[model samples]
Target: MEQSNTTLPSETWANSSQSPAPMGAPYMAAAMLLFATFLVGLVGNGLYLWVLVMKMKRTVTTIWFLHLVSCSVLFTLLIPFFTVYILLGFHWVFGTGMCKVLSACTHLGMFSSAFLLALISLDRYTFTCHPIWSRRYRTMSWAQKLVAGVWLCSFALSVPYLVFQETSELESSRITCVDYYDTSRDQDRAETQAWRQHTHVVLFLVRFLLGFLLPFCIIAGCYSQMGLKMMEKGLARSGKPFKVMVAAVVSFFFGWLPYHLYYGLTLFKDLSKSLMGICQLICIAMFCFNVCFTPILYLFVGQTFHQVLRTSLFTLVKTAFYEDLDSDGVGPDSSGRIR
Candidate 1:
């Protein structure tokens, strides 16, 4: 019962002393997926960043995209370390500092991405429902400040990872990175166990709420209203933008929901080990795929970005980030089209 439930599958091999190679098939696949995702996400998000920051004009839309890509790129950069960790049969040769740093980065990436998606959805809702307000307030300066606050919040939430992450040398002579949340180390056994369980439950609930559930609610609410507005205004003729929006929302929903659900269920005491392993492997696959696929998902599902991408690819990248504006500054941009 001393084992942290948050410990990943790498730390759950049951026999850490034995090299994981023999039973590392699923892990090996995850490592390979991470490697491939790292390559694609790095290049794709990197190029998108270059395009947004360097080639495109500075606007609120471009600003949002720039940071989104930054998050993706930052997360993608950490993929190699994870892949190496898995390749090494989950051994923590990277030391305690790296262990803490990696955990923080992982949480930071997830938090920022989730927050950004929610913000994006809110932006769409405001633009569609309150165009005058969005236009007057959604300046580049405002957007920049808002994004800074997001990063600050994300970092704040990630602080727990740095605090709890530790590299523990197992009895098997293998070192594993894990969440050592038992703060009452000097307390009685019952007290320590209670503290650890409390910490685990609190962390899991907080992460699930902020990282997935709350954001999802915001997204669903915003998009639902937007859809109603579009339908009422007879603006659903094209179907392309609506389709893209639906696709993006659905993708985001499915992408992280199951991972959260699986981990949340793991909190229950009765779940069997075999079930946990299967769920863990599936979650890991989804996690890896999402890190690589998110930016591309936005790129392809965004009608504006997709159209520009179709025209001449990189040559037209600059146009993709441009907001659709009219002389009155309340044009298609007000419709909350993903630019």
Candidate 2:
């Protein structure tokens, strides 16, 4: 799932660049999660987008929610492209530009989501703990500016990846979009390999640092401080908002932790192929679920959605938990009879 891993050792990057992970549960999980997440995530994110845009007015909170759901919606819309690619055995017939755009959008959405979520958490903390300052300073215009800055930074972070990704024709003639990492330079293997190693370490650190570690810490810290402040002020007695915040923070952390771990450990590939393979499945599934389901988990965990019917467990979960995910029972093979 990690297209460009610059944290890998030079030797590993050179030797394992073309090697796919051992196919088993992780590979299958990726396929299943792709389909399932797309199905559910699309509906959930779409409904949320509609609600945030059409039903709600512009505010600081709405601005944050707008960007958060926007990231999820963009990721969900791209699912069909990836689902097709996976079903076609991962050969990217989508061409080089499509590949770049796809990867760019994904990375951008991911970065934006993480950053926006952190900003939202911080906003909540300030609104709760420092109400005076929040009332005085928090404005939709300011939030909009912040959101713009986040998008710009996300785009910048993802551009290198977009540039590096290309369609590679394997010796077996199977073409897949992958990061070539400029290993194609006229320089000898040693020079290119050295470059690969250097760039990988830098990229790995940058991606891991900005994309996950730093954001996670900030979100966790903001919520923790907010929770403590609310508890002192007796507002934490409600418990529901705390639960939603917990869900948000936990979902973000768990969703992408495996992804970071996989790439981080890929720097040392000889550790255990089987273990890494299994980790991939967990990572991909959770990550996919996060992109689509976190909004439901966070936004609806505190609210009650009216259940339209008693259907399967999936439908029941979607119904009682969040109508946004159901979209009237749109499954692989289903009647549009959610009612």
Candidate 3:
């Protein structure tokens, strides 16, 4: 519920080498949250990546999803540096080059994540609702082309961040990557403000529509029809693939809706500073939760749950008590008659 205050004093702070004021408790809390998020994301996404690469065979769906999870892993790798920066009161100890790279990577991850979800939803629609037509046109090669298109689009969308990001020394002398257009000293500050207002309005509309609203509508509609089809066909309990599909779609919404809502609210100029900060923190938390929860949902939401669990447990037991079986030349099968 934190709000952002956009008004800045006319005179820019002259001193550029001063240390930032200590953030004390809030900074510590942000750091802790980032650490916890990093650990969860690393473990969960790592396991998913391992399973996808080393265990599961390639399919059209799996190919796209593998890239999606790879992007999340790359994004989460930056959490520690971000945590340190936030804990140090927003100081950017890393150089300006790192600022651009980190900012671009973060934006790329976000844009790609949303677009992948949209792509998955579209694929589901094609496969389930129009299977014959999809089979004719949606070959593995087609999927690869679509994924490539998505990444290209995402990179293009993030180009503005590369241009806009700059490291500057703040009033307290700490360096930070400031993402705002400063025109307070211009005689046409009013025009500048108006231009900013228009830009924000357009950007918000595009982001909400392309990134959130349209994708959610497509996903929801596709899943609703899919669920209805399953029910009508009396396949609800027949171990249908649609059940797993439903769970994944639902998890995607639950994980991302909060973060997007928070992002939308930042467009309001009247929002308070404290509320903006809190909302920013909450959005970050929600994003991390999305990253951590997705692999679990993917792993457990289908008929593979029991099989995977059993296989994992069996492997653990074998590794634990049979460490010497290899070196001792023991053969369990040969001596099994003792049982």
Model 2, 1-339: lDDT tens digits are 235111111112112343362334545566777778878887777776775566444555556667777777777777666656555555667788887777777778768878987887787777778878877787768888899999999999988766666666766666666665533444668777777767767777887899888898898898778778878777743244446556766777777777677667766747775576566555556667677677668555655455323334343333222222112122223453433
lDDT of 3 at 44: 75
Maximum-lDDT candidate: 1
| lDDT accuracy of residue 67 in candidate 2 | 77
Give the range where candidate 2 is weakest over 10 consecutive residues by summed lDDT: 4-13
TM-score of each: 0.83, 0.79, 0.77
Q: Local error of candidate 2 at 51, Å? A: 1.1
Candidate 2: list runs displaced more than 4 Å: 1-29, 182-188, 237-243, 303-339
- Summarize candidate 1's per-residue lDDT along 33-54 as a digit string, tens digits: 7788788878877888988777
Candidate 2, pairs of clashing residues? 6-200, 6-201, 7-200
CA lDDT scores, all candidates in order: 0.64, 0.63, 0.57
Q: Which residue runs does candidate 3 get wrong by more than 4 Å?
A: 1-21, 182-188, 237-248, 302-309, 313-339
- Top TM-score hit: 1
Off by over 4 Å in 1: 1-22, 181-188, 237-248, 302-310, 327-339
Preferred candidate (TM-score higher): 1 or 3: 1
Whichever of 1 and 3 has more lDDT, that candidate is: 1
